[model samples]
Target: MSRKASGFTLIELMITVAIVAILAAVALPSYRSYVTRGRIPEATTALASKRVQMEQFYQDNRTYVDAPAGNNDTGTSTYFDFTAAPGGAETRTATGYVLSAVGKNGMTGFTFTVDQSNAKRTVVSGVPGWTDTTVNCWLTKQATSC
Candidate 1:
């Protein structure tokens, strides 16, 4: 009489499990890294957008402004939305970019700053309507190079 084969042997099962585990081990980290790299560009775009908004605001207002209200709420607003965007949060100093991003603690981190001497532009934050973290947007002046 013919008999059905038994379940897989221990060695076969172990080999399959090991193969799956190995594949997972390699895939997981690579996936995470890919995601992280993708995010960096989003952040960079956000920052660049902020700089553009600053320039536009300067032209309209004739003065540098900070985190103007309604920029995030309304598309017409000439300000960047760092929180909504990817640069985290940032500001423009009179002589450089004062980019800020919230960190692990209550403390904030400075991403980077482009000094006036190098870019021939002024960047400042903490203006009448601006805050360190909330200063995601900025307004530039007509005469100012931004």
Candidate 2:
């Protein structure tokens, strides 16, 4: 009696590998974009919380300049470096503040900014759906208008 092959042939294995390669190539960028989008909230939340604290400081100190400058990560994020702008500058007081989160580690090509007016902006260029200009909309992975 003749027996047939019990395993995949070389041609079939090669085709499978090619299919996987193509799938990965297509999915990788989308996955990366999704991850980057997921990390955006870290910046937004940190900025929003800091904004509240700065407002409180203003309520007590009557200035946004003296509200201390530093990372306010709360040990929850590792992708971006947070900063409260105009922190303790010679001005001693600022009428407005700009909170920013610069991408760190492997999270490059993204910079998020928010001001006292709550105007959010993304300062990244060449991103698939992101604008390089300062927009009134929140910095998100999706292309949106403010």
Candidate 3:
């Protein structure tokens, strides 16, 4: 009596592995880009909200200097570090301010900045396919306009 193989043959298994590898090769970068894009709102929202607070503080104190320090909504961000420009310069008090979010961890190589003028800019250097210029453009994975 002859019996048929009950399981996949070596060639069939190899083909399956190859298909999975190909799929992963296509999907992985896309997934990373999506994740990076997701992290951007954390920066933009925080900066915008801080801008409001700074404006309020200016209304009360008549200057941008010594405005209350802004905190990251989560206390600690996973992908970026938020900072206010003109930080702690006792000799000079800023009439205008720039808030920035610098990428961290796996998100390193990008920086987003917003100023009192409400201008937005991105600086991308270490990331591939982007130049080092700090261009006035919205931050995106495509690095378009910059």
Candidate 4:
């Protein structure tokens, strides 16, 4: 009498492996995007906090220049670099200031800004599964506008 094998065959194992590989290929990019989106809060919240500081500075000094010490810093966040971008020689002016948070490490291609008008902008996005959108607002997720 012929007996049936009790274990999975090589074809079955290969099929399972292929399925796992395909799932991983699809899931990894999505998971990466989710992680990147989580980091976006760091930038938005930091910019909002800085805006508050700038407002307080304006209230005290009547201008946007000479922000308080360490006011421009995005502390302890490894995903972004903060700066005052400039078209002219000046970044901070009596009339206004522009704060920028640029992506770093795993967050490359992402940049954001908030100016004196309280305008929030997404300058660019390099996230694996996200569109930059730049819809005159901060993008906290892929294709979703804020």
Per-model TM-score on C-alpha atoms: 0.51, 0.78, 0.84, 0.84
Candidate 2 differs from the real structure by a C-alpha RMSD in angstroms, to one decimal, of 3.1
**Model 2 weakest lDDT span, ten residues long:** 84-93
lDDT of 2 by residue, 83-106 (tens): 654442343346777777777765
What is the lDDT for 136 in model 3? Answer: 94
Backbone N/Cα/C clashes per model? 10, 0, 0, 0
Model 3 off-target regions past 4 Å? 70-75, 86-94, 128-133
The C-alpha local distance difference test score for the whole of candidate 4 amounts to 0.78
The C-alpha stretches of model 1 lying farther than 4 A from their native spots are 67-97, 101-146
* Candidate structures ordered by lDDT, highest first: 4, 3, 2, 1
| Pairs in steric clash, model 2 | none
User: In candidate 4, where is summed lDDT lowest over 10 consecutive residues?
Assistant: 68-77
Tell me the TM-score of model 4. Answer: 0.84
Q: What Cα-based lDDT does every candidate model obtain? A: 0.38, 0.70, 0.73, 0.78
Question: Cα RMSD (Å) per model?
Answer: 12.2, 3.1, 2.8, 2.8
Report the error of model 3 at residue 106, Å: 2.1
Which regions of candidate 2 deviate over 4 angstroms? 69-76, 86-94, 126-133, 144-146
Candidate number achieving the greatest lDDT relative to the actual structure: 4
Q: What residue pairs are clashing in model 1?
A: 57-140, 58-139, 58-140, 58-141, 92-123, 92-124, 93-123, 93-124, 94-123, 94-124
Alpha carbon lDDT of residue 61, candidate 1? 62
